[model samples]
Target: MDSDEKDSIKNESIEEEVEEVEPARKKKKVSREDDHEYTVFIKNLSFDTTNEDLKECFKKFGKINYALIVRDNVSGHSRGTGFVQFEKKESVEICLNQAGKIVLQDFTLDLMPALPKGKVKQIEKEKEAKKVEPKDSRNLYLLREGMIMAGSTASEGVSATDMAKRLRLEQLKSSMLKNLTRFISRDRLTIHNLPDSYDDAKLRKMVVAKTGSKPIECRVMRENKPTPTHPKGKSKGFGFLSFSRHEDALAVLRKLNNNPEIFSANHRPIVSFSIEDMNVLKIKERREIRSKLNNPTYQEKLKIKKLKRKENRKNKSENKPAIKGTRKAPKQVEENEDAFSGFASKPGSVPKHRGTFKLKEQSKIHEKSMKTQNKLRRRQKHELEVQQEKQEKKFDRSVKKSKISDKDSLVAKINKYKDLLKGSNDESTKKQKSKKWYVD
Candidate 1:
């Protein structure tokens, strides 16, 4: 061959060798990275779709290694979700991208990559954690939406939503102020025994006359307010008085709290703090209770519930029929004495043919016969006792044949018997073996 041809041949062989090595390396890389089974979780499938239906629909894209529509184990019905595994990774990508357009038995497919069982559970836990949200500005907006009437329409520029929120905040502020005012006048006094004829002006004059100092405010509730029918508001017999100083209020409370002829000339006054004071005390008590319950080391403080279960088996085992306190036997009964059933027989269970007179005669006859039977039984019992004595004597004589065997010699006797049996070769051994037949 020519030199140029030989050089061309050597280059061609080297190129072929390099091409083979490149393909081998590519195959190795594919095995390590892209060799996993490309599985897709498909949802919104028709209930009638079967594994065969899925395989036929997806087989056009690539060779499907497996296709299964999950079914209820008990009902054998499709679960509307399925798994499809394609042999090639590119097929899964193609299926995912075309998921929106693909239709399976009148339903569009929803497809995504199927994660491992552990990863699915972890994702669910994260979703649950995200669901628990703290209070924020959005809560007010939500409340506004709920509170607005359906018929009430909204307008632009400071809509009803904002108006509702502003109104709610104002109401909350007023309530907070009221509560604070109550706590601030914790030492203020109230009297419930004032006469219904007394008014706010009259009570104020009395306080000034007694304490020699004017109060900050005096409120008197009317039993009925002045209306078109009445020109004067009737006093309700209860009122609150606040002082500028706590010491002045305490001094006024001590003198006229239960004093007659001051607020009440006839009886003592029901004097105390406002209802808010009691509520504050209750709040403190509840806080202490919650703290005790929340303590982890105090096992008894935690709520423990005891459930009562019906003891079916124990009650059934204890079910026994009453045996004593039987009713009197009926007259004219044809029932045999041996046929005495448990407790008692029904009232009308006697045979129709038996007469009451026959029953009375039978009772007398039965008594006389019982007496004769008792005498005969006594004679027979005596004879049996004599016979038992004779049998016992015979048994004692037979037992005496073995004559005072020592307990310690039992092991020696057992060993000696075993040796005698073992020494036999055929005849005696065969006899012993023949005697070993079971009783049953």
Candidate 2:
């Protein structure tokens, strides 16, 4: 072949290769441009919502390429948001237009146009740049560069001590915000106007899905008595939930309260802190009062009062002159003084007790009789002990006799068994001798 023909053919082949490569490059460019246009970003999604649910919700708009629920890498739980890509860009526009009105799985969707990572970053930077500063800018400080203080060791930049102080202040501010949030929330919540279909399990699940925390207790208040039609009792359209931590309760209240779309209920559910019962407060106060009244100090005070009252009665009796009709005989007055010393001490102070001398003489006689009765009881107890010992000795003697009899019986049985064994051995030996004689 000629050199000129070879060069011409090579030039034509190069032109064809360029033509093939240009179309593929153009196609890639077109695909890149359409990537963000057909995809829709969804916010405020329910955690239980799945990718299939997302596709089913927006299938009416256009053909879906795929739907995805963003999930945590470690836990594999939904992040409460997702993305949906459509075959046509017009479907995404339609979905975004009906964003707030669309409800899927009882959750209202907040839709936005999906953007590339670089574009999203650029938009955020622009927003930060466009933010208007306060009119009195002198109060604002920048962390990167600020006026050098007189005490700063570094002449050109912020000192190490100042940096440390700034970091400490930031930490304190963050901690204060966390504590403030905790204080703002409550452990128990009262929910009003709940749906008829809602029950304890559903309420707990909803709270867990919203807050990622389980409630300590959850219940739906029902009718006092169940009717034939409603065997489980009809719901009163209210419920309560108690959470372990204030943050969980706050998260549930923020996410579920006043959001009718969560339950698709006709009315907005009201969630607020549960009010403590007045009866409970009264019971607590009554218990505290009862405890105080039964205290040792109060008991001692009561005993002191009784002693003072007795001393006061004694003084009153001593000041009063003896009346003619109330005068007692000398012997009777002495007996009265002895009997009433612990109570009133003075004679005839209390006429409730009469015939004191006769009663004292009878009490002395009764004491002598009681002592004699006790001595008789002690004698009876000693006799019972002696009888028990005699019975025990008789029982021991009988037990020894029974043991001797059992031993004689066992010895006789052993001898009889030995004689029977010897007879059997002699019979076997005779049979063996007869068999040997027969063989010979």
Candidate 3:
């Protein structure tokens, strides 16, 4: 083949290889447009189902960008619903059709497009409404008039209007009136061992009959077992009864605390109750009072006052000169004669001078005794040294005598052994000579 023909063949081969590689590149970039995608819900999942399982199950129809299985917050178990995102609307419809009613473990799946934003908001609103409605119903009794009272300092015969003014009802309404009235009127009644199927209305009727009230409000404090002290399950057989009147509440407490019949089939008591005043105290005033009561400085001041009184008593006792005996008139006669005459008299004339002279004499005697003790101790030390020297000389002489005697005894034994050995050798030689003559 000519060179031009050969180059043309080589070019064609390279072109074919380029076309093969280009198709793969195009396949990678060929993704379904974002507008074509929508989230699809997959329901009836097994409790243990996971996101990866949902993706893998849907991937057969088309590309699944993401998948998730909803789980319960408390149980950490699947909620039997999940979401799957497909890259194409067509794929989403296909997944819905194919996966719908699919049996997974013990559940049958339901596939549909996820609720739109508007529908989601509506559902959330419904849930919030349901939650708020119950609380409002429980608290409706607080709106009744004449159910609360202000402090007694208000005008003695004050009407409701006057009382309201004194208590600042306008501000109270905006802040604490509702809560405080509710707390004051509320009574805690424990219903024990109630059946699982017991309803609040039935429980309320039972409480009303016991307390003689038209309506009784009750709430089952949710049991939270993980918090063993507070179980999350329905109160096994007990719940609290809150009354709208303090009179009814006190009556319930008086009658029910340990009355066994008040409890359900479980025989637990239903009469326990606590009344709490929900009034809010001024924090600053409370804090000021507490500081005064607990102040370390205040306590220290009290301690110092006590110590000062004790010290004054001790000083008074020490400063009061001791009286030798009861007062005498001779002491006055001497004072009247002359204070200067006493000073000019001889040094030993007065009893005080005589006591001083005796004290001096005692001190001299003690000093002379100490000097005699020192001389005796020195003489004892000298005598001890002389005795020690004599003992050391006697030990040296005894050791030398013992050494000479041991050497003499050893020399005598060696000479005696040598003489015996010489005699034995001479006898042996004579015996050998006699044997030699016989052989010749």
Candidate 4:
């Protein structure tokens, strides 16, 4: 070969070697700085998924360089998030396109391109910047669009979107205020901490006494049961009083608010303008809806309930007989030889037919018996009272007799002792007189 041709061949070989090294260097630079472009961040991963499991899940999509589940350092448990790095950036695009459709170990994955370094911090800063501080009186006008502030540039002009938002905010404020005011009833007052003995009649009388005016309507909230002590219902310690005039309601509120004498000790009544509670309003609305006959479902339910009640009534009537009271045994009926062939005949016996009594006669008999039993019970109670009174009187007479006997015995003993002392004194006086005479 010629010398020039040998030189050209050497140069060509050197050029090919340089080209291969350049491509290799470029690949290393791309891997180091552009790794985020080829990696995908998967969220909502199953905690039980391991690196091998994740890799197996995505291996069908593309060649994966690595699959890892982000784990807590101390506990060695999955953080429910991980990263999947592919050999090419195209694989990341393909995986992201599948996004929510990818399921790994019974978990739907949310896939996104892995953020480059410092990108997350930038996003957080942008979010913080987007948050608006609460506007008060000073900056309130500034928040409203189309309001020209002094010494400010108007080059941007007023944005229609900002103006619309401001209008919406105003509407929202008005709606909120209306809702708040709607809860207050104009001519009604709520009374709390009422006496347990106060029912509708007593509560109305109290309102008339305190306020010196009759209320239009008064109701004490109560349990849904009728008790012996309270025939209507038991008081729930609260009530509502409504007046025809708003001024009268206000006057009643002032008279009853924090009134310590109205209720028992330590129970001061709390009276205020009746504010309808939302939960109570909801319950009232539900009851009203249920009560409306126009609703087909409610009508059907009522029909079913009526049918059940009818069935229950029929069962009760069939199972239980009337005239449940004490009565004499029924007289035995005589059997006829022709009608009852098996019966034996007795001489001089009349054949009497069995008779059926009417319901009215049975009912009258039961009522008469009940009345007699009640009279007997009352007579027995009266007799017991009379016996108790007689016993008490006898006890009193015995106690008086014992006292009189004791007093008489004490008086007789005193008189006998006094007589004995007088006799002894006379005997001593006689002896002294004899001595004196002898001396003389």
Top lDDT hit: 4
Per-residue lDDT over 84-188 for candidate 3, one digit per residue giving the tens place of the 0 to 100 score: 766678887776777545676667788777776567799999998776322332232322212112222211222333223313322333343334333323344
Residue-by-residue lDDT tens digits, candidate 4, 1-440: 99999999999999999876454334434456788888898899988887778889988779987777788999989899988888987778888889889887778999988998788899999999998755331111211212112112321122333223323433443343345323445577677667787889999988888769899889999998998988778888788998887667655665565444566334455555554546677889998986786677887888999999999999988988677768787444233222101122222223221122332343344445546666898999999999999999999999999999999999988988887776644777668756755534
**Ten contiguous residues with the weakest lDDT in model 1:** 336-345
Q: Estimate the lDDT of model 3.
A: 0.54
Clashes of each: 0, 0, 12, 0
Off by over 4 Å in 3: 1-37, 99-101, 131-440
At residue 286, candidate 2 shows an lDDT of 100
Question: Relative to the unseen true structure, what is the C-alpha lDDT of residue 250 in candidate 2, on a scale of 0 to 100?
Answer: 49
**Which whole-number lDDT from 0 to 100 does residue 157 have in model 1?**
21
lDDT of 2 by residue, 286-319 (tens): 9988997979798888899999999999998888
Q: Global lDDT of each model?
A: 0.59, 0.63, 0.54, 0.65
Our tally of clashes for model 1 stands at 0
Positional deviation of 310 in candidate 3, in angstroms? Answer: 84
lDDT of 1 at 358: 41
Worst 10 residues of 2 by lDDT: 138-147
